[model samples]
Target: MNVTTGLFYVFSAVLLFAAFRVITARNPVHAALYLVLTFFQAAMIWMLLKAEFLSITLVLVYVGAVMVLFLFVVMMMDINVENLRVGFWKHFPLAAIVGVVIALEMAAVLMGGFRVVDDPNAVAAAAEANNAKELGKLLFTQYLVQLEVAAAILLVAMIAAIALTLRARKDSKYVSPGDQVRVRSADRMTVVKMDATQAAVAPVAEVSEPKA
Candidate 1:
């Protein structure tokens, strides 16, 4: 086999292994780390495909930023692995069926993609072209509506997350900026004035001698 094909097989093998470990790892942090490995492997495969921009973006965005955040969150969370596994066996059958169906669907799509023939000249031209510029052109022209829709969905999701996080809770305390800005000193403190009173003095009883 050629060097490039051999490298592709090696990367794909590692990627699949890492992806499996991502789901099967007992510790959340370990699972996240495995996922990061999967991303790196996928990025390497993209590099072999000559999509340098996509490969670097996959590394920078997912491996560097997203996976780091995921690791931090996983590490910080107090996850009870045993408790999480309690229902795993109970739900395994249904989950397996769904997973199989999804895998079949993906296989069909990939098989179709593999059957498509590409022109060598066009592939060479595309390889020589600026990846980011071409991607931008496609996003703005052919996929403009789809891109805008995706952005709008992301915006809505962000707003929804903020709303959920900031929602008032009876068990939690929060302050309103408007209330703080409009607060008056008089409302916060009150002083009562009273005349000073002298200290009470105890009366002294004259010592009665034994009357003797």
Candidate 2:
């Protein structure tokens, strides 16, 4: 009925549509673009919830940086789409079941959240306070260990991903910085001493004045 509620419904619909497209789109680049749209819609919803910091962060970090990198990677990689879809039908049932379970869990959590009542004064205080400042306080104070653990886990995951994807190819050329730093000019170039040889002269038969 209200403009805010109308906007929320519109954004939620777009977010759901974009999210579906992200998973179902055939082209990886198109999927990534759809995911970016999904993030943007989610960010808009967060803005409507008055979480400005989260909204901006989602836009800047996910849409601006992460999605751009993902798009570039998808574009650059030689992915076989047909090969990827080979077992789609075989996996569809299990995937659908898992998706349904997750959706149910999320719905339960959201329903619980809706049922919980918040103090009006506390809500007003929270709304008045700086979002980023309050978030930082909570992160550093109560959830510091958890935050550190999450960061460590993310770092480990990044390292593992790099390790798994990295391959030593025999055909690919790579220069070792240590070897380069330790290289010597003498090792790089060699001068061979050799005797200078004269050019060979071929004997020519003299033509006797064109046989008058």
Candidate 3:
């Protein structure tokens, strides 16, 4: 096989392994780490396919930001693995069925006999400008509303996740922004004034110098 094909196979193998580990790992942190590896491999594959914009975005956004956030959240959260695994066996059959269905769907897609044919005209057109620039222009002009909607949905999902993971402990202290904004100096501190009296001082005891 050619070098490109060999590297593709290698990346694909690692990607599959990392993806499998992401699902099967017992620890959430480990799963997140594996997911990061999966993202990296996918990004590399994209790079190989000359999709530099998507590859860089996948690395920067997902691997750098999202996966890091996932790792931190997974690490910080108190996840009871034993409790979570309690019903795994009970749901195994359903999970297996779903997995099989997905596998069959993928197989159908693979069997569709898709081929990539390089068009010289398209390549010549693309050579005039960078793909990222073209993609940006298209997204901003043609898909602006869809893009904004997607961003809004992502924002909502982020807020929901934060709300869900938030735990209110009895000992936990929370400061309200509204209360802070409304706070007055009188509420936080007391200013007391005392009158000063004339001092009657006779406390100093003077000692005579000892004879050398």
Candidate 4:
């Protein structure tokens, strides 16, 4: 009916289509791309809901970083499409049922239309307020220890990933930092000091020609 409602419907439609494609697409790369589209649509919806901080974070973290990583991983992976599709028809009914259930649940939730207007002025004031700053304050004050723990966990995970990547491989050559730091020119190379003398030529023996 209204412009906001129209935009919501449009974004919702595109989001649903993209989400469906993410599962149905044969190619993993295409699926990842579709998932990116889904994330973008969800971010748009968050923006419309006036959750600017969440919307921007969703776009930056998920669309920019996570989806890019997913695309890279999907593209790099050697997937056998035929093997993947082998059980598609066999599993289609169950997948369709689950999908239908999720759709119904979402439809039920969205039946309560958008625009919560308990107080328009309050909503406008809240919208004008700095949500990112408020969120940061809450994180630092209310859930500081939890936030720190999460950060520590993420750091550990990152370290574990790097450690796994640095594991020794028989086929791969890795330069050790200590070895590089301790390397000497003398150990790496030896300059030969040979004189540039002309090579000696042997005298040719002249054979006496026999009378033919």
Clash total of candidate 2: 0
Off by over 4 Å in 4: 102-121, 183-212
Q: Considering only N, C-alpha and C atoms within 3 Å, which residue pairs clash in candidate 4?
A: none
Q: Give the TM-score of candidate 3.
A: 0.70
TM-score for all models, in order of appearance: 0.72, 0.74, 0.70, 0.77
lDDT digits (tens) for residues 25-109 of candidate 2: 8888889999999999999999998899999999999989999998888899999998877877798789889999999999998
- Worst 10-residue lDDT window for candidate 4 reads 111-120
Tens-place lDDT digits, model 1, residues 95-122: 8799899999999988887644478897
Q: Is candidate 1 or candidate 3 better by TM-score?
A: 1
Number of the top TM-score candidate: 4
What are the runs in model 2 whose C-alpha is more than 4 Å off?
A: 86-101, 115-120, 183-193, 199-212
The TM-score, computed over Cα atoms with residue i paired to residue i, of candidate 2 is 0.74
Between the candidate structures 1 and 4, which one is better when assessed by TM-score?
4
Best of the candidates, lDDT: 2
Q: Per-candidate RMSD vs. true structure?
A: 5.9, 4.5, 4.9, 5.3
| Segments in model 3 whose C-alpha atoms lie over 4 Å from true places | 106-113, 116-119, 123-129, 154-212
